[model samples]
Target: MCDDLQVSYPKDFKWSSWHVSCTCFLMMTLKTQSELITEINNGQNFSSEASENFIANTPGNFNAWLSENRESLEKRKSKPYFLEENKKFVK
Candidate 1:
């Protein structure tokens, strides 16, 4: 996870107290993609031995997991770029 906070604002952007506070809060709370993925994996609990074994042996489990959790995932700032680039490959 990156500890550095890299916020980009327009040249005419003004620094207000509310803006500053929100920015600070977001910087402190946001997690990187890998970090979020690890967190989700750590929190997962299998209900049955068969299900656990299936996930463990699955070749595309990571992608499957990401797809399943896509709606709940908080995408990073660069998500737009990725979505654009991969749009052609997505069904």
Candidate 2:
């Protein structure tokens, strides 16, 4: 899954039981709407134009925005991006 997502780690990095537990916890957890929006805006998953359009269209209504883009967001979240992004914390 990490390879499929193109999330690479250091060649010397090793996955321990703690790392696996943390990864599983991250995958199973539900992120808040704000966290999702922030991630979408900050991430490379969506183009700048798309992010701008989402913000413009939503106008502070994250719930509505989430409802409209739930599937895409879920797909994005399912990727190993979080593992890569939060690798420091995991380590």
Candidate with maximal TM-score: 1
RMSD of 1: 17.2
**Clash totals for all models, in order?**
0, 0
The lDDT of model 1 is 0.36
| Candidate 1: segments with Cα more than 4 A from true spot | 1-62, 73-80
- Per-model TM-score versus the true fold: 0.20, 0.20
The TM-score of predicted model 2 comes to 0.20
**Residue pairs in steric clash, candidate 1?**
none
38-76 per-residue lDDT for model 1 (tens digits): 657899533333231222221243245446656654454
Cα lDDT, model 2, residue 27: 26
How would you encode candidate 2's per-residue C-alpha lDDT over 15-81 as one tens digit per residue? Answer: 3323233443112223456656787798835433343223222123323443565577567746344
